[model samples]
Target: MDTLAIVILNYNGQSFLAKFLPTVLANAEGYPVYVADSASTDGSVAFVRTHFSAVRLIELPRNEGYAGGYNMALEHIQTHYGGATYYVLPNSDIEVTPGWLDPVMKLLDANPQIAACQPKILSYAERELFEHAGAAGGYVDWLGYVFCRGRVFATFESDQGQYNDNQEIFWATGACLFIRAELFHRVGGFDASFFAHMEEIDLCWRLKRLGYEIWACGQSTVYHVGGGTLHKSNPHKTYLNYRNSLFMLYKNWPADGWLWGKFLLRLILDGVSSLLFLKVGQWRDVLAIIRAHFSFYGRLPHLHRQRKALLKQQKAEVPLYPHSIVWDYFIKGKKTFEAIVETSEK
Candidate 1:
């Protein structure tokens, strides 16, 4: 039997952990589980130690965001569990359905070119609804926005038979990404600069450059409670989502007109969005967007150097069609964000 190491990054999620740990442990047969705690104040460390004695715990001194926390935990896995053939980065708020891992591993075993695979993620809270974060698989737009199958922004509908067929995708969500340990190391793992959002996309883009395929297995499924740790309405998450997207574009896109063209388009859209939010008095979101732009600008030089180095290492350019991934997100005549704010105020 091939060894597997499950790396779960925790941050003040004791409440979820109470339920998450048991479900994960039950599904994690023939695998070792590692809980990487990011200095949770809510006795999360103690809870895990008491309940999951067999699980390895790596408690950080302080919160190092998502990327840092995972990287820290990965170092231990690489050293101690070097024999692990598969490495799973599962979020702490997910419940693995029966036979989820077997399908994913089987696909990876059969397809030597496939570097990573993700399970069909369903919504935990909404039950019948597909999870907004990463419904089945993830894809990106030319404008650098990320969307998933069975969902696009607030347009999540019933699964139906939309994504029943298993196929290759541009990227897989980090929430439940499974990768071959060797390929993960080959592409150098998730970019730490992202800190959180879109890091998986960045990693997958790099893996594609190295001649690896990312797939979504329809047979494997998991339930994810959307916004379990960070509420969707939270300004902090909005900021990270926006900022990290820009960082991703800079790092992954070819260092030429393509990169600048996309970056400029994002700038225009974000600027308009900020103004629109201000007009409607969504002050927190507006401020969050501003902060994200300024923070990214501050680190432009370092980001440029990193991009140059990464581009040089690329062995091949994977062609992705824009229309295949570009989604409207505003389905069924849904009200736009501005309209929602206006109507709410009225």
Candidate 2:
């Protein structure tokens, strides 16, 4: 019957658990913490049960990845601990700061329209740099290209207090997300089909369509080891990210001329990315993007059905950037987020 509950999802991340659990447990005052284990074979369950006995555990039958695991865990939390007003989904590899939850919780309580928010995420390895996952807050371009306020493609801005103000954002990072329990279920939770990347953005986009806002609680901060489960360098990670981004676009975007135009533009961008990888002799990465495109095309009928279902849930038109991030970053040489914003305004 607490006001907040922290649920950390684990899948063969015993090392991460061992390293980061103490900080989470230490900072988790006035709330309960649970480790939702998705059939971890690395003795993560045993480690938690033995060392962190105070933390509750939810054991899943198989590794359902991030979207599925969280969906399952949140369902359990809502059903069993219905009294909890907020659910904090922090990655297992995050080193949370003390009072991290207060700012986000206060923001949610103060604003009834905000369905979710995230703390400022810094890099665990290089603490001065904004983490790739969710630096300050998340945003997307017209072409479905996702970026953060402090991060662009392969470029991260240093934490220089520029993004210190709490502000409304397109999406909150799933890394240290604090969401309203009721609103989360009402949005039908995350699309489990995502299975990994871009799922949080999809969920936030859905919430936005329903006229709910998302924000960033910059006062509350956390350091995340960017790629705990799937390393950024992995070709499979590239495949999932590329494919899921397309899936998200298909489901959320209006299926008119706009959708096709954006999809074509994204395809061109993806081709350029593939050629860049080819130039670097990253054959696997190039192939991953190609495979991702094929998979997306193959799944269009199913995704179209999902798109129709999502349209039925729309209460308001979601906002999106009219400009292309690729043109801004690559063609115009706008490196930092501040520069991008400035140029857009001009």
Candidate 3:
């Protein structure tokens, strides 16, 4: 019997905890549940302790964002519980379904090559539509853009059994990631510097680069209420997504003559996006992009060192979408993921 521990990292989300934690507890009857609070002053820790006493609690000294908070919490789990075979890191806002863990667990157990996997994530609000964070499974395009099988840019596909087949994916949703315990530590876990967004891709890409597979088990499903912490419109979330995307590409993409060109292209795209925001008078978003660029520039030295460290590890040629997602979506008017994939195949 494989030992699995489900851990949810919370920060000032007492209400989310109040609503969703019960569903998680009800569904996860056999496995132990834990609530890792990131020093939230909103009494999240107290609420968990008061209502859901059986759910183990870890009180982090300070809020260090998702990457750092999870690292600390998982480390504690490894130390305290003797080492669970699997770790399921679900967001505070996720509503996991009954039997959700079985398929993903079976997939991981059946394939030693698979390091991480996620369930088919639908939207909590719509229930039938796929969510934005991760619709089905994620893939990295030629331009380092991450899109899901059920979503493309802002266009989300309805739950019409389109992505029902279990398949290999480029990345798993961090909203509810299932990872092997040993492999998580072997790769040094999530990069704490990522702070929040795109950290899952950074971790998954490392696993992918190291020749380990990430998977999506279609048999299981979860509903995600995204932007629980930072709304999509928040400039800070924009900064993290844009900047960490650059960071991920910088650290993981093979260092070659063409890598610089790709970076340049991405920069131009970022600038174009800022102008679009400017046209709409989203001055804050424009500043966020500028700030993201400058922040990346400031971290170049650090990223260079990190890149060299990654090179020291054994690597394999990771699979990529091999097409320009931006061109296919914006120029060719391919809105759905199925259309993009069909055109790529042709």
What are the per-residue Cα lDDT tens digits for candidate 1 across 110-206?
9999988898888987777778767878777667776677776666767675676688988988889898887777666777777887888888988
* Ranked by lDDT, top first: 3, 2, 1
TM-score sort, best first: 3, 2, 1
Worst 10 residues of 2 by lDDT: 254-263
TM-score of each: 0.90, 0.98, 0.98
**lDDT of each residue in 1-346, candidate 3, tens digit only:** 2389999999999999999999999999599999999999998988888899889999999989999999999998888777689999999999999999999888998999999999999999999999998789999997899899898999988999878778999999999999999999988999999999999999999998899999998999999999999999999999999999999999988766688999999999999999999999999999999999999999999999999999888478876798999999999999998899899999
Please identify model 2 stretches exceeding 4 Å from their true place.
none
List ranges where model 3 is wrong by over 4 Å: none
lDDT of model 2 at residue 293?
Answer: 92
Task: Give the CA lDDT, 0 to 100, for residue 41 in model 1.
Answer: 93
After TM-score superposition, the amount by which residue 14's alpha carbon in candidate 1 deviates from its true location, in angstroms, is 1.0
lDDT of 2: 0.91
Q: How close is candidate 3 to the true structure, as a TM-score?
A: 0.98
Give the clashing residue pairs of candidate 1, or none. Answer: none
Deviation (Å) of 298 in candidate 1: 1.4
TM-score of 2: 0.98
